[model samples]
Target: MIPKYRQQFNQDFSQEKYSLLKEYLKQKSGLEPAFRVSESPIFLKKEFESKLIDASESIIDQIKTLSPDLLRKAVPDNCYVPGHTDKPHFLTIDFGICRSENGEIEPQLIELQAFPSLYAFQKVFEDTFCEVYPFLSEIRNKMPHEEFKNYMKDLILGNEDPENVILLEIYPEKQKTAIDFVLTEKLLGIKTVCLTKLKKEGKKLFYENEGKLTEIKRIYNRVIFDELDRILDLKTEFDFREDVDVKWVTHPNWFFKISKFLLPLLQHQFVPKSYFLHEFPENENLENFVLKPLFSFAGSGVNLNPTKEITDVIKDKENYILQRKVNYEPVFEDINGDFSKGEIRLLYIWRENDEPPILLENLARMTKADMVNVDFNKKDAIWIGSSNAFFAE
Candidate 1:
């Protein structure tokens, strides 16, 4: 974060500007976001920007070289989908800003997701950000606007009828990412269908639209894999694990293969030392490590401060990961004069068989609590929610 811009931006920031921006968000999204959008965006210099990219590349290279045996070990038994794609269509790598022993601000790898972030909505978010504050209108990000849109089109609507491609979810309206689903529909002309609503005959899947069943050719799956079982007596016409007649934009198998499961596999200066909870040595200091459920999303089932009792109670060792906690430095100055800790999530996209995904955009989360998450900070104002950054050369 730059001191000059931070001071200038804070001085210039007004309640009316944020008020109009919030209203625009409500208007653009036919629905209110279940989560809060931060008031300001992060401003980054080129030096730190390069560090973030170096960290992402190191992890992605490890993903590319991961052996089949090691990758297979990541699969949750009986949870593997029949059709596994060679590469994930979308992935996100999260990094925490930390101060090195040398007293320099550096990026430390936190977590990664093989799923999409707010891809469609981010453009709208940044656009609205600039629109509200007219002087900041020339802000630019990593990927060009038109190029990114075309890339998404190629990934989501590839060689198939856009009508047949649906964004798959379980009770999509309940998820916080429901806005993304709506934006996906508006941009690609694909509908968001509930998993329970899908009808299957033999191995083919179809969904009723306008009183007729339209065959589904592809699915931009947003359904969290774990949620599939939690639904009580939920009879889906087709099982996700079944050899169904649809192409997965990013197959389910890659989600497990490239998730927190890969954290232990990644060996980098930026990547923290990690171990499977079951295999973690008794001699090693567990006091500094954080216990995380491998598959939980949006910071669920994570224990920031864990005890011996917590680790002993876990029956499924493979499902839990013991990760070293990177102390997120409170570097971003808040408008109220209280500094806040932040986490920067770098979003990447890779086509099938691509060695490494291209860094598409950046997502930042700010918080005043132990963890940079919504649940961690319930009532913190400004610099406390989802945001983006402008990388200046």
Candidate 2:
């Protein structure tokens, strides 16, 4: 969002540099990034970075207190977590940032899930950053991708056989982000299998591979329980809660444990004031905030400028939230040399043996409107979706 850095980078930009960046990325990573890679990254002020880290730490501490209970409730069956298991213990937390009324960059907690993101592609993206942008050698703005991969391996496999641990997802072929699934397979050497492929005998889960039934020792679960509920006649003998043989990469409870629904409960100076849509008191200035469905994904079912009648008619009040709208600072300068507003999704992963959460990757979204959600963008906008590039500051 620092305008001076943007101007400096644009002033020194050249077609030769851009061509080199593209060639180097394709040669090194074998995949071309869909977004722009700029000469200059976001220059996050030290104070702002520190505040962001502090806020994240505070939230983590809070979560530590309640995580055990939350985890217990998330299981469909009441079962205690086992101590020794060769499965991935994964945790992810998401944050949404905005400029506060005081004109300082502030972060608001969005959601946390015990699921795998585009972990494999992220590692490749980091490698591209190193190859294309040699000037960033001295900068500390990069995520430790190799370290992250090792940590994941250690957490998921432990001392057990890597062949036995599988990253479990639904029929991944039917999923939109199957490219990520393929990447995970290539990086970890773990098979990505559909739930239907799994055959259960008693409490043990097994999948037939190469015409033989192999025991499923550890499960790196990527299936969303909400999505699973929609399957009509899909038969699977395994029970996620009752089966002791399969270990969770991320225990399912954390999805609900740290969600946007809890934003109204967390007291933070940086977080905008929020309330359950049902519990929201009558305010004549209803236009001041946005109404959002608690559990929807990718900016679905959100009313940016909600009216009183719209808020009043919501039947599932508990399933909705009203959050004060914060203006998105126009941070990214586009190809046309015009400024575009955007939001950054800071990706983090917490391993079983790690003392603290590790920042693994970052994905930014650009938009032309006052808000950064996809619905607000114009039809012809080019720089409005998921973007990743070298950021050194």
Best by lDDT: 1
User: What stretches of model 2 exceed 4 Å from their correct place?
Assistant: 2-43, 67-91, 140-144, 230-244, 283-285, 353-355, 370-376, 389-393
lDDT for each residue of candidate 2 in 83-124, tens digit (9 for 90 to 100): 333222454445555677677766655554455666666566
As a TM-score, model 1 comes out at 0.96
lDDT by residue (287-380, candidate 1, tens digit) is: 8899999988778899988899988999998899999988888888877898878888887778775566777677888887888876677564
Listed in order, each prediction's TM-score against the native is 0.96, 0.81
The per-candidate count of clashes, in order, stands at: 0, 3
* Candidate 1 displacement at residue 380 in angstroms: 4.7
Show the lowest summed lDDT stretch of 10 residues, model 1. Answer: 134-143
The global C-alpha lDDT for each of the candidates, from Candidate 1 onward, is 0.83, 0.63
Clashing pairs in 2: 88-156, 88-249, 90-249
